[model samples]
Target: MLVFFTFVILLALTVTNSKQTFVILKKSREDWILDGIGLFFQGIAIPFFQIAVVFQLYQLLLPDTRASLNLYPIAAFLLSFVFVDYLYYWNHRLFHTRKLWFIHQVHHTVTEMDVLGTSRNTLWTSFFIVYLWIHSLFIYLLQEPNWYILGISLSSALDLWRHSSFSPTVNSWLYRCLSPWLILPQDHAWHHSQFIQGNYGANLKLWDKIHKTYHKSDQVPDSLGINSSLSLSKKLFLPLE
Candidate 1:
């Protein structure tokens, strides 16, 4: 699936450029070298940040769960994942609108699209996933097991895909046909395009369609950011836009 979607998207981007333009775009190698470290630290950061800050407060209101019926854990885990994805749809659409674009614009500023581009985002951008709060609320409300861990895993996987540039999956008919339901590179490219209305939600495709923010064209283009003067990498400072 990844290969099929990544290929079409990469092909679309290449045809748009007549060559792979992002290959020449330069960001500091120091930035590249530290990505794994960043990933590791961040792996620990948000959970600690949220658990220490939020979940601890949550557990205070709950009865003892160390001996409770654990069967609910699986249902809670699966349900929480879907709800998080669903709310991400709204949070993402909001970022595309004028009210939230400033934060999101920071991310699209990077003219270079690569795996490293995933980690180029600012710290506050992490808060955009504050939908984790929703996960927290449900987990606390239900006191399910391992909800927190599932949140971390699902979020990390989605974030990894957001910055992955060269997927070969987009070439398949199933990918294109299902593009409206899933966010493939074509949809992401539209969000990253220079033209107006390209910036929309990332994880879910239907939100853009329902909200009338979707951008579609038979021919793809070369440029990927707003025509701004600031360094593109600096633009990822905000999750809005």
Candidate 2:
């Protein structure tokens, strides 16, 4: 729901505000098809994955904790912002390694940044993502706290914004203050650069800083994605192979 709604809103913004152009890649029909296939596979996998997550959470929960909501909803909600982002940082870093890079490469293939562009990886990419699996399990174990849902809602909105082409003007004090800790569109746009190793944060920049992978610079990347071209079959199956 969050992903769907965010995509719609951002796409609308992109279309309406035509004058503010930040497109890096010229999108083609092939690109749209690839993203659509990925999105379809992702939607199909999620329900099945959640079924497993539910069963696993049931097995792990204490007998007395059944049918209970989070005792500390606020803390759980606040903590999810840090916890989920922390998990994303490591999961993302792992994708850049030699073995996993192929699975993630599709996302960077498009030089452009957009709401749909971010979800353009191969079918299995989302299935094996560590952060998604672990985060879902955690939410189930916590009994679906309201705060946790709220935190995720806020984070998902930001996620869409970061993937979109708009780079917010950083002149405001709020931007300056949050720029260090939170990821903005500019921060993530650079991650799609050919130099894709650094800036692996999801919502917060703290993990990248701690791991010494944070990158900030005035220079926009010269180019995006690798030069290698992949066939449709390869794009769909090479990651698994």
Candidate 3:
């Protein structure tokens, strides 16, 4: 519910903001096809797969540990928001490396900041992401995962927001509060910039700051995304450098 609400709000903001709306209007047919397919696969298929296949697979592999680890609500939340977040930070950074860049480059092909492009990636790229495995494993192991689920929801919401052009005004109270810790849209724009060198954390800037990959900037990059010669089919299936 929260994630949906967040998406609606962000979409509304994107449609209303002239600059963002222009970006949306400029989207090509191929962009729509890629993003639409990505959205359906990420939003629908991924969840269903997690519940039906991944969770069941975990049940078979760790039958004795199904919902066996009981934890306090706060502990479970922290486990997802902090521990898993840290793990994904490294996982995301690894995607930028030469060996894995081919699989991840499709996502960085977006030329502008738009929510629709949030999930843009090769179809099987989710398998390389830490969330698919770690999130399912934790949900299976934790006896009560409500708080953990909430954490996931919040993280997912942030992902949507950071991928869009919706951002708090600079120097505003909201910006001041969130910019110090959270990964804002502008922060993420740097990651998707033509350079694509730093700011790799998904939810928090702590990991990037700690690792010296955080690029502090008050302005969005003039140029965004990488130019890809790969066709839509190749991008969706086998994106080779």
* Whole-model lDDT values for every prediction: 0.56, 0.73, 0.92
Candidate that beats the other on TM-score, 1 or 3, i.e. the better one: 3
On a 0 to 1 TM-score scale, where does candidate 3 land against the true structure? 0.97
Q: Against the true structure, what is every candidate's RMSD?
A: 6.4, 3.1, 1.4
Tens digit per residue, CA lDDT, model 1, 144-180: 5575446546555655555545434555676567565
Candidate 2: stretches off by over 4 Å: 1-3, 19-25, 43-48, 51-69
Best by lDDT: 3
lDDT of 1: 0.56
Q: What TM-score does candidate 1 reach?
A: 0.65
- TM, every model: 0.65, 0.84, 0.97
lDDT of 3 by residue, 1-241 (tens): 9888988898898889998889889899999999999999998899899999999999899999988999999999999998999999999999999999999999999989899899999998998999999999999999999999999999999999899887899999999999999999999999989875999898889999999999999889998988999988998997442
lDDT of 1 at 151: 50
Identify the candidate with maximal TM-score: 3
Q: Which stretches of candidate 3 lie above 4 Å from their native place?
A: 239-241
Model 2: lowest-lDDT 10 consecutive positions? 18-27
